[model samples]
Target: MAPPVSESPPVETLDLWLLEAAMELPTPLHMLVEPNPHIALNMADDPRLSREELCERLSLLAERGLIRVHALPDGLQELFSPEEISSAIDARQSRTPFGYSLTDAGGAIWEHHARPDWSRFVNAGQEPSADEAQDAWVIEAASLEAADAEFHFHESLGDVHQPVGESKHGEVLTPWQVTYWKTLPHGYRLRYVTVPRPADPARSRSVPSRPPWYTRVWL
Candidate 1:
């Protein structure tokens, strides 16, 4: 049997940020399908909502303040039992989960965190790419020397990297990291690796370009 799902940590901000500007969605179906159980659903997993329909509904949601736009990293976003969510909310390097209510604020953020640009949430605090990361290198994998003299690789998840991949045992690699290891000059020690990134598009010093006539600058 699969292990239980873990919950997400709570976010503190609660402004009425529009879903559309956050992450694109079609409709605003804020009603919880399973309130007592408080299960989260994503039609993206369902086949009934055609691509067009899905887009329509997601778009609608985005247009309203019912949701927030956030992007999921390569390895994140899964159901967590109330207990797991509870735990995360209880402890964090930063904020904590308020409660199970999915406060109008939390729900609103969760739904639209994907709006303006679905990548926002997923990329939060994401290290600048290697080049951008400067020395920013999200750990792709880590390992401990095995008893049998084999290298044990532990993929990073929110460790050296945010939303880093889960470990071989399928647990978050939050604080645990690869401390010591042996590798050949050409042979990598871990199963995976992350290279530096180019740069942050948001801060790139690109040359200014003329805006279309429709856009005007006060200056």
Candidate 2:
């Protein structure tokens, strides 16, 4: 028998554009679907929809709990910033298009069922107050080794890199990472951690990105 659909909360609803965006995501990394091809097949170089439409689509996606959107990280932006028009074109061509990712519930719904009014899937989670948000243990790179000791890999939503049975520290840090780290000047090394957001565990918020469960790489 098919498993029953999980109950959805009041907040988990999706409009058509939001549904399309969720479906189009290649992975849970904010993939830029702004010039959504499906919406405008050969429509134009720019978004066929007006700015209001685009903004509304993005807003509805977030408000309905299908995806999380945030400003591009400054460091990452600088790394990708183009030096010239040609460079800009090259960077855009090569870059992993990033923008928004489906929440846990969004993933499940996307995989198991036809597109739904995603807002229907909201979790009846209590909104965390300033105090609770303050108290949440956001891990820092320096503390990764210590934190790994306390939580089993599966216990915490945040442990993105630690894997099972790969090493004493239990992460399958990729082979390239060793050479990459060695090349860096002394006193710096790669740190594996999740992007911190205030957790609204009950409802859909950005779930932490992790390496594939089958093979792990520390980011």
Candidate 3:
């Protein structure tokens, strides 16, 4: 018989941060526990976790099958439980590499906990209809705030064409920031959108915006 599923631990601020980091890239245990230049630069203000504490939490996630610990390069050939992987690292066994990646369950949990309202936003790939495309949309780009513009769909243009809009602050939106977007209703006004920061998971900051716009859109 399969082993019973372990109870999921309380999702702490740091745990969500770790899960997000692993999601972006399969992370080795050391990268999380030790002070690395990348982590130092990106996660400067985040709390520092000891190896033991990190391992314990990771073990819980593994036992619950929320995350998978496996051999690196290609994790399919060999898999390791959190404890087993931790022991290998402690022993300084370099022959085999280990890293963490979220399982389906982990991804679900992370989405549920981290981006509770993400479903409202439409993905960038899902282009608006010809009629809808004619209207301006509020786009959540890489930078903090959303941009109001009309996305293109020309044959030469790829998934998203060059967007043209009235200049407010002369801010430019990069291709990557054009990830998610939503339409603004006719009489609404644009207000601050709250987004969670990975560095400081506990607190949420507003997506900076200018004074009241013509229509309000929830991001």
Give the number of the best model, judged by lDDT.
Answer: 3
lDDT of model 3, residue 36: 62
Q: Mind sharing the TM-score for model 2?
A: 0.27
Segments in model 3 whose C-alpha atoms lie over 4 Å from true places: 1-9, 36-41, 77-83, 90-95, 116-219
lDDT tens digits, residue span 1-219, model 3: 123332355666766666666654566655665556245334434446666777777777777676777667445743445567567455335765676777666766665655534323322322234454343334333333322221221111332233333312223333332111111221111212122223421222332322321112111
**What C-alpha lDDT values do all the predictions have?**
0.27, 0.33, 0.46
- Which lDDT tens digits does candidate 2 get at residues 94-192? 434334445555544443444333211111111233553222222111133433533333234432222232222222223211111111111111222
Local error of candidate 3 at residue 126 (angstroms):
24
Task: Go through the candidates in order and give the clash count of each.
Answer: 47, 11, 6
Q: On residues 1-219, what C-alpha lDDT tens digit does candidate 1 reach at each position? A: 112221234222322222221222221232211232112332222223333443344333323423322222111332233333333333323332121122234343544333322111111122454454333322222222221121122122222322222321222334332211111121112222243334444433342432221111111
Q: Which should have the higher lDDT, number 1 or number 3?
A: 3
